[model samples]
Structures are given as structure tokens and as C-alpha cells.
Target: MFWFVDGEKSEYSGGRTAVEIKSWCTEMTGPAVKEISSRKLAEEQAGTKPICVYEGPEASTDFEEIAARKRTEFTFYHVAVDTEKPTVSVQHKSEEPVACDDLTFDGLKKCLDDNTLPLFGVLDGETYEKYMTSGKGLVWACLEMESSDDLEKVADEYRPLIKEVAEEFKDQFAFLYIDTIQFKRFLEGVLGVTELPTLAVNKKAGDKLKYLYTGEMTAPKVDEFLKNVLDGSIEPTLKSEPVPSSQDEPIHVVVGSTLVEDVFQPDKDVLFEVYAPWCGHCKRLAPEYEKVAKKVAEAGLDDMVVLSKMDGTANDSPVESISWEGFPSLFYVKAGETEPIKYDGPREAEGMWEWIEEHHSNSEGLKERVAAGKAVHEEEDSEADKGEEL
Candidate 1:
């Protein structure tokens, strides 16, 4: 006789009666089984869907092949179990099938969670967040999805080419098509896509560096663009204001095109400030930063040092080591060093001067200038004292 609990086989006792078996089950499971049954009943009453699994015999090769072929079309996973080799593997659409290292229930759940996203699909709000956090680079085809017949024709011409490239690089990157009208702001503001049928790639790690494709939309051209992005041969696209015609203020103005020349000078120590025009913190720090710049100029340190500022909202820094999460970010780049040092001290002029003095590489000319300035100050103080005595 078999004892069943909650539709699952529990135990077998050949000599026990029904009453004895019921008593034995209650004694063994105690309150745990009752609690589980209550929860299951509540879920069923609440219309919660249960997880479904499909099983086929080990000898069913036809079923396995069909499942493998249709895996990308459906939401369910196709797991192939090899009875002879005793291995479990999941099929992928464009890449080789991945073998599961862990066969436990939790391990299989983790594997499914990791590989659930489609190889290529339309990019939407929900899928954007998922793909960006998946640690994979994304290739976006920005097309006019709901526009006129002419625009629709343009999209139709490019969609197939994008899909072909996606299939070829499926294992390296996740490809997606975006609705240009729906994501117009993002395209213009972030990716710098002013025209329709634009293609871009975002390497989501670290700084989320992005590159734009400007070539004709063909399968081979798109493939070459993606290859250039992966191999680091293409320069990342960045938002930038036009370079200033003249920068004559105490604080030098910097833009994306002039970043390497102005703020990253190898022969001079540079203090750079990145600020947004609307930020209250940047507004408050403005006067103090101006004071610091004037002081640097007055002290005859302009030759050895440079003070510069950039509108962070309107421009992007090309320096690989420079990035900020907040406005009014300050960085100190020493002479001959590309790595920047963040300033975390007080925002006042004197505090900034102290920080700069401590960080700047002192040369003989700088030392002589400091000494001469000190001597002139001492002479002026002595002359004032003599006037008081008279």
C-alpha cells in the first residue's frame, strides 16, 4: 500500500491500515505539512498560477530536436537531458548550447534566470533596464516604428540588416530595435541621434561608453561597425558644446574638443571643475572658485598651474579616468600625470588653495615665485610699521 500526501507519494507500508497510515503521516510531518497545505490552498484560491514543467521520455530524440528549434519563439526553456552522458544542457538560439554545472533545483532556477532574455528583441522601458544591467553590450537600431509610409519603408529596409548583424554577434552583444518616435528625447539627448534609422552601441560597464554608427545601413557595414566598437577602434560619441572662440578669463573655459589641450596639460598642474548651470551647489561654489582663480593669477602661479571649468550638462569629458555622479565635481591633475585626484575638502577659496598647494608638484621657479611674493609682503609690512612710528 502507498501513502500519498498532497498528491505526492509519501511512504509505503504494507501492513498498516488507512487509519494507521494517516496517524503515522501526521506524527511524522506534524505542523509543517499542515502549514504547507494551507499555503497551497490559499494560493489556489487566490488564482496564483503554478510553475509548469513538461517531461518527455529519454529516448524521444524528435521531441528534443523540435523543442530546440522552437526555443527562441516561446517563453519556456528547452532542457535536454542526455541519459547516457548524464548531462543537462539548455539550448540557445544563435550560440552553442550551455551545459548546466549544477543540477539542484536552486541551481537550475539561477541558470534560467540568467538566460531568460531573448537573443534579439524590441527595446522598451522594461527591457532597457534588464539589458543594461545584464553586463552585456547593447546594439540599438533606432527606427521610426509608428510614422508615415516613407518612414516605415526606411525602417523596413534597415530592420532585416540589423537582424542579420544581431544573429552574427548574438553571443557577444544583445541587439535591440527602438522606436524612434517614442525614444526621441533619449536619442537626441543621450546617443546624439538626430536622424532616423540610427545605429549605436552602448558598453554598459563603468562609464556606459557609447558609440554611433554613421555608415550606410547594410549587413556588412553594420557588422564592421560592431566589430570596430568591440575592438576599441571607434571613438565614443559624447555631447559637447562648441569650442569657445576666446577663453580670456582667470578660469579657462573647457569643452570636449579642448579637454586634452586645456585641462590635461602635461607641463602644468590643472584644477578642473565640472558644473551644471542649474545646480544650486555649483552656483554657491562659483564665487568661491572665482576667488581661487584670481588668487592663482595674482600670485603669478598661472604659468605653473591652470584653473578651468566645464559645463558638465552640455559637454562630456573624453578622459577615461574622469567622471562625476554629481555637479560641481573638482579634480586636480598634476603635471605629467593623467590620473585625476578628486577634491573632497571645503569649497572655500582658502581651503581650495591649501589643497592645490599640497597636491601641486613644486618646481624651482614656483618656489622662487613664492619666496619673492613673501619678501614683497614683508617689505610692505615694515614700511607700514615705519609710517606708524613717524
Candidate 2:
């Protein structure tokens, strides 16, 4: 169950938007629980009504059991709906331009302290793992160096520009700096950083990890890249290891982790199987999945619909997406469509073809599938809202 306060229209009109409660979850679930609890209490005492306890589909059944152990275990949020406009006091404060903080060891450490956005700082191994490795949505890490005064000057020169961009994307993305001198191995080994002032955008689409941007960083160039990433115009670099090649099989091997290259860009309907090695169900479904792949190729849907598979066990970052429902999961990615539709029909090759023929060919059905895929993400966000309490 997730708890948050939301504004609605008189119970007559509908309203749905999750806000401020996001910050509360971090404080309540984090290390400083006592401090956060006291603060939360103070806020409530100030007459801020707490409302809405939403129960999601994936919420734990053992809510009472968990609540027994931890008093903060939120079962439901009080629903706060306000239709009337209330008068409020206006307090004026000095307005100033947002500033960017320079990257340092201490500043980088502090990045992990909370979920604050536009947190631009140097990223070391510690910061990288906490913010980048398992990072959700768009996380930007711009690499810099202190080896040369000129290089430092270049970084300093772009600080304001970065700050401007960060401020605009503060709500959706996280921007950080990485000093190559401090974390040389991580820069080279993990991120494959070669150029100075390379602005790299780390993103995960579905279960696939991809870098949206990694190149030269000028104000205009970086701005264009940022725009492209936001609008889904830029191609994403995969974060997973290379897919093992298979010569004899009819199945097309997904060479890298880039969903854009293998899944989205291609003009074909994709039947993707996300399976774990250890799962018995996955093992049982492998041969059938292969059959579906071979049959699809034979049916001449190979160009229109390609069959693909990814080892969920082998790849972590890509599969860590909110799109990953479970192991042995199958999805239908229609050609030219950005969203992949979950395959809930029979697993047999014939059933697969029928499903592809019926929904993939029908434009309206495809739209519903897209809408359904979007709903899944919304659910995931709600679950994330409840995660802190658990």
C-alpha cells in the first residue's frame, strides 16, 4: 500500500497526481527515520492534511504482518480531495538563479544522502553505484578532470550551462560530475569514458539499460542532446553484455543491450522472451519459445515480426526496468510502436501467431496495448511510492 496526499475536484470530477509524498517516503524509509518521523509530525501539526492510501495490485498480502513489525508500515493513504479554492497568505522571498555545485569527494558522497535532483557533482565508485548503477529514469554523469588547468577551466566554463540544463530537467533527471583523476578505473572500466567533458545520459527502457548520450559537451550540443533524449529522438547505447551469437538457429541474436538497435528501431514486430536461467518455468518454455521463433520466420513474419530473447539472469541493468514483470515473461513489440505489449495468450507457436495477427495488425488494438503498457509503468511508480514504507 502507498500513502500520499492528492488534490481532487469535489468527488464529482476525478483527479490523479502523485506529488510531495515522494520526499516523505525517503525520509520515513531511510536511515534517519526518527528525524524524519519528527519532521513529518511537525508538518501534520501545521494543518497540512494527509490524505489518500492507495492500494496497488502488487501490494503485499501480508500488510498486517509487516505493519505489526514496523509501525511505519503504511497500509493505505488518506485520500485528500479538495474542490474549493482556499485563500492563502502570500510570503515573498528573494528570487535568484539556480546554481551548480562543483564535484568533490565530499559533495559526491552527499549525492547518495537523498533523492534531491539537479545534484551535479563528481562521481566516484561510491557515487556511481548509488546513483548510476541501479539508477532509474534519466541520470546524466558528465566526466571531467583536474589533471590540467585548461581542462578544469573547460569544466568550470560549462558549469552554468550544466546548471541551466539541470534546473530545467531537475524533476525528471539527475546530473552528476565525475573526476577522471579521482575514479580513473571506474571512468574507463565501467562507463568507458575516453573524452573530456563527455556528457553521458544513463537510461533504462523496460529492462534494457542504455546510454542515451556520450559525446562532446558544448552548450548547444549538450542542449540538443538533452532535448533529443527527452523527446526519444536519440539512439540509446545498451548497458548489458553482448548477446551470444547463435549460427544455426532461426532466431536473430540480440547483439547488444540497446533496445533501440534490436527492438525499437527495426521495422518488425518483436516477440521478446525475458527468461531467467535458473527458473524451471523458463527452462520448460525455452524450446516452445524457440518453436515460436522458428515458426514466425517460416511464416514470413520475420521481416514484419522478429522473434528475440534475452537472458534475464545474464543481464541485470536492462531487466531492472519497471517493464520487467517477472521471469519467463513474453512481450510483443509491434513494428513502429515504441511500447511493447505484454503477451498474455497461449505460449504455443500457433497461439503466438494468432495473437500477432489479431492485435499487431489491428491499429486500435495496438493502441490499447500501448495504453496498457503505460498503465504498467504508472503502477510501478505507485509501487515505488509504497516501497519506502515496506
| Local distance difference test scores for all models | 0.65, 0.50
lDDT of 1 by residue, 1-390 (tens): 444444543224222688877775554443221112222232332111111122222313333333332222222222233344434444433333445565545555555445545544556654555566667777777775555334435545665666678778866787766777766887786677877667778765334357887678788888888888888888898878998888789999999778878877878999999999999999999999999899878888888988999998778777677888889899988888878889787899989887777677775556677778989989999999999999
Best by lDDT: 1
RMSD of each: 12.1, 20.4
Q: How badly does each model clash, as a count of residue pairs?
A: 0, 13
Candidate 2 per-residue lDDT, tens place, 1-390, comes to 333222211111112334445555554445321122222232343211111121222222232222222223211221222424211111101112121132232432233222222235444433444354334454445445557334345555666777677666655566665555756665454454556556656554122444545555556777777778778776555445665654467766553364445766446677777777788988877777788777655544455667777665454333332246478887777777777777898777667666766776454654465466578879999999899779
Residue ranges of candidate 2 with Cα displaced over 4 Å: 1-137, 142-172, 177-198, 202-224, 227-233, 238-247, 256-270, 276-281, 291-306, 311-326, 333-340, 346-390
- In model 1, the clashing pairs are none
TM-score of each: 0.69, 0.39
Off by over 4 Å in 1: 1-114, 145-159, 205-208, 363-368, 380-390
